[model samples]
Target: MPLLHIENLTHSFGATRALVGIDLKVERGEIVALMGANGAGKSTLVKILSGVLTADGGTIALKERPFAPKTPHEAAGAGIATVHQSTDIVGVPGLTVADALLLHRIAEHRTSLFVSRSGLRREAKALIDAAGFSLPLDRDFGELAAAERQLVAIARALADKADLLILDEPTASLSSEESQRLFDILRRLRAQGIAVLYISHRTADLQAIADRALVMRGGRIVASFSRPIDFSSAIQSMIGRRLDAVRPDARPVGNPVLEIRNGQLAATSVPFDLTVKQGEVVAITGPIGAGKSRLLSAIFGVGRFACGEMFLDGRPYRPRSPAEAIAAGVSMAAEDRHRSSLMPAGWPGHSLAATISLPHLTKWYRKGFLFGNRERREANRAISRFGIKASDPLASVWSLSGGNQQKAVIARWEAEPSRLLLLDEPFQGVDVGARREIVEAIRVRTDRATLIATSDPEEAYEVADRILTIDRHALLPTAADPTTNLAITGT
Candidate 1:
């Protein structure tokens, strides 16, 4: 019998129907993967199952018993827990490892307020050890790395005694090694008879851990398959068509467009040399803290190069700051769109307009206050061009879905023409339609020279004309050459 079951689930936001008549089931100890393009209702279903949002209509059952959790706390109480892709840990600086663990125990009411510190510490230690984490018991959780933060989230879910674990894009930012460690932990959890609902865009991770796969499109589950499924067929189902042909702009390589000669960032210990050409996409792949980010930052002028030189379009260009980089015909779409790219508090129209008319805005802001009417007009133009889903231009960015939020970020860069574009994880949480749109946009930008960095090998192979792997702070050419076989590897 299935451990959890859903039937005829439907949901919407205002007039927008986000999900329609969806059904799914997870058997005991099974790892089920939910695959779809961004905005395909995968997140909506997750929200319903995790009790973060109520469904408009549906029936849910667990162990053949009616199941309706009213709150996230209730969902945990009923043995379902979800770990979101974006880490949401707060107040960590004030809380010790033991305190964080005990807080979970307190949330579940497993112990009284007067619980002994020694007992809490002992239990916390056991959980940490069991999860293969080696943090000091008294250390603050805020000091831990990104992977450690994820492990802590998993530990908290385990503490709830959850029977089903829903992980959303858990490996998006992880390095190859950190990702392998996470897979190890998932295997351990599976061995303990825990069912997993895995959500991710990377086909490699899905193939590694999932027992069953469900492809969602247009707010519906359109296809389902058991294990040993073909990767190409699965992707085709998710995208609703074959994506075998290389993008038309992905032309044969030519002369270098941008060159980095013995570049070094003293603050980050990144020393590398590389080049990107017109009509070619080059990817930089490495593990977390491998200085891949720092390398991009240095190249894009977010950080200064302490030594070496950079040439853009055959002209010496060492930008002192991001503004200088933009002035030199370079733009970067950051990895953390919410914090780094989007203006969270600004009105959607204002943000879109600012990005679309950045070159003019930069000049206008220097002279005087921006004309509100003109700004809105430009912003509206960008919104329509990018097909951004929002009711009003004045809507706050926080009101949009994750995929739409990402699209807004892409629109910012796409509005202005540049000599070289640098994108970091451009499709992180984007849906299928949005992913296709973004990829097509990149393909179009190939005539303008583009470089993208991603952790997913399949994504790299899909979008890049050449794959460059970062190993020991050096860039090495991969087998993604036009004439060579595409052989992926970790260094």
Candidate 2:
């Protein structure tokens, strides 16, 4: 019998049907890849399987026995474990790694109240040893990098003895080497007869790890591919369209919009000089914690550095805050969309137009009242400019598909004219179709400078006119690319 079996699974959120008559099965030790663009019902299906949501109809059988879980705890007890994209935020930031790993046991009173701190550390260390991974039990969970936090979440799942593992974009924030290590671990798990349902937008990951592939669109299983998966066909089926395999040609360049001289990312880092000109998109590539995001943060006026001289449009420039940066003709889209960007649907003034106009509300609303229809007009203009999938500017942004939501965010910054625009990991949690749309939209403008920071080298090449690399907090010249014939220079 299959390890997991689903029949006629259906679910809905208010008026929108999220899942419809879904049928699936996973045999022991099988790895299944779930491919879908945002709002394709992948999250909804995972939620049902993880016990975050109960299916309105259908039946699930695990090990040929009927299974239904009412809560996340119930799901884990039934051998289902999930590592969400943002699993880093699951534990208290102040807790030590050992305590963070033991949080569930403590919550369920599975551990003795009298256990000492050393005991917890020993227990956590043992779990890590048994799982064949390394982690610092005494480190504060908050201080761990994104990759470390993700590993911690995975370790916690293993500790639960879960027979079925669900991973959602597990390598989104990891370096290529780190990603390979994760794949190795998954293979080991499969050898142990654990079934895995892997979710990701990265075709490389799907190819490396998936034994079978399933595409979901509009709340239904649209297509499924077996071994020797036709990835190109699978992607087309996921987005319901063929993508232009070519990167858009670069726009013409002008004088520099942003220039940095004698800039130091860290106190001990190499001093560097950098320039980004109007109509040019420059990407800085690095691993996590390599200080690429730090450069963006400093330019966006959210982070500070010990030494640097910046010039904007041929004038000495320094911004003390984000508002100051915006006023000086600079706009930034942060890496974490849900945390740093986005006015979610339920909040007051959370319409698509409102989200676009939020940062400039002082000039639009002024004090307590909205002045006129200008906000809506700009919102509509952005919507059209980016080919956003939304027809109404007044609708909740959360209702749009995943790719469209990112388009909305990019549009939010693009609505106002700026000399420089910054995007930090702008492609997070988005699929290839949406990514290409954003790349096209971001490059179409020839009047401003665009600086992109990404850890993915392929993504850097796809969107940028030039690519730079950072190592040990030092900005380094990119090796000459034969395809582009560009000599990138830096420190």
Candidate 3:
């Protein structure tokens, strides 16, 4: 019998139906993959399963027993734990690894009284060591690197002793080595008879870890395959069709649009030199802690280089801040869009329009208010151009689906006539349809220079004109063919 089952799962946001008549089942000790293009209701289904969102019509059964969890807390009590794609830990900047894990346990227990901190710490230490990690228990989480942060999140979930664990794109930002470590943990969990529901866009990972695969589209299970399926066929099912093999375009290379010589990331010893020509799309891929983000941030001025000689369009240029990067005709769409890109409480229309034509709106800031009509006009134009799904220009950005939110951010940057575009994981949680739309928009900017960083090899092969790999804090070129999985190495 299946460990968990969903029947006739349907969900709608207002009049828009996000999911319709979806059915799925997971058995004990099974590693099942839920695959889909963005907007196919993959995230919605996961949300429903995790009790973060309620389904309008559906029945869920745990071990043939009717289960209707109203909140994440209720779901946890029922032995279901979810590690969401979006970071949701509170006071993450201050919490330590042990503290974070204990906090999650306390939350699951829902206790209002004092707990034994010593006992919690002892248990946390055992769990961390068992997971093959040696992180300093007293170090603040805010100081931890991205890979370390992810490990802590996973450790928290495992500490709950959950019978069913849901991992949503856990490897999206991780390097290959970090991902391998996670996969090892999953294997351990599987051996313990705990069921895992893994969601990811990286086909290579599915082949390595998943035993069964379920493809979701338009909020339904369109296809499923047992183990040993070909990777190409699995991708076809997830995308709902075959993708044309990407070939490098034969275009004349123009003068260098961006150049960095002996760039150092603050106090780090990792230094590299790189360049991008006009109209070229370069990709930087690497294992976790390989300094991919630092490189991009240094160039974009989020983290100023300690020492570097840089040139933009044949002129000396060194931006001290992100605003300076923008002023210099460079725009970057950061990986953490929820935290960095969107102004959650701000007006959506104004936010979308300001990304492209913002200097005009800045004049109104001094007047202490914005002209709604002007903001709406520009926002509406962007919404139509980018195909953002919302009822009105005034819709809250937080209310839009994840895919649409990503599009809104992309629309903001794409509207600008930028000289250099740095996009970090432009399609991280986006659905397939939106991915195509976003790619098309990027491709249309043939006159501008662009650099995209992604962990997914398929994304790099599909969108990049040239691929660069970061290995041991250095960048090296790789073949740009989509047919083969390129092995990134330090040269």
TM-score of each: 0.83, 0.92, 0.88
Model 1, 1-491: lDDT tens digits are: 79999999999988878889998999888889999876778888988888889999989997788888889878877889898866544226667877876676686577777778788898888887776666567877766545456666766666566789999887776666766777888887788888999998777788888899999887899999897967677788887888664533436656677998877656355566777888777777766665566677877888767778889988998888888988888888877665467654555434555545544566546777767676567557656766777776655655566777777777766666688888888888775556766777677655667877776665676676667787555666555345434433221
- Candidate 3 Cα RMSD after full superposition onto the native fold (Å): 3.5
Candidate 3 off by > 4 Å:
108-122, 134-136, 230-234, 237-239, 266-271, 345-360, 363-369, 373-387, 431-433, 477-491
Q: Rate the local accuracy (lDDT) of all candidates.
A: 0.74, 0.84, 0.76
- Arranged by lDDT with the best first, the candidates are 2, 3, 1
Compute the lDDT for candidate 1: 0.74
Predicted model with the maximum lDDT: 2
TM-score, predicted candidate 1 vs. hidden true structure: 0.83
RMSD in Å for all candidates: 4.1, 2.5, 3.5
lDDT of 3 at 430: 73
Best by TM-score: 2
lDDT per residue for candidate 2 within 160-193, as digits (tens), equals 8789999988888787877887899889999999
Candidate 3: tens digits of C-alpha lDDT, residues 1-491: 89999899899988878889988899999999888876678788878878889989989998789888888888988989898876646327777667776775566565434756676667778878777665677788777765567777777777678889999888876767778888998999899999999988767788889999988877778888998856567667767678666544546668899988877665556677888889777878766666677778877888867777999998998888988888888888887776677764565433444433454445445676866776677678768877787777777776666777888787777654789999888887775556776777787677778888776667876777677887665676655444554333222
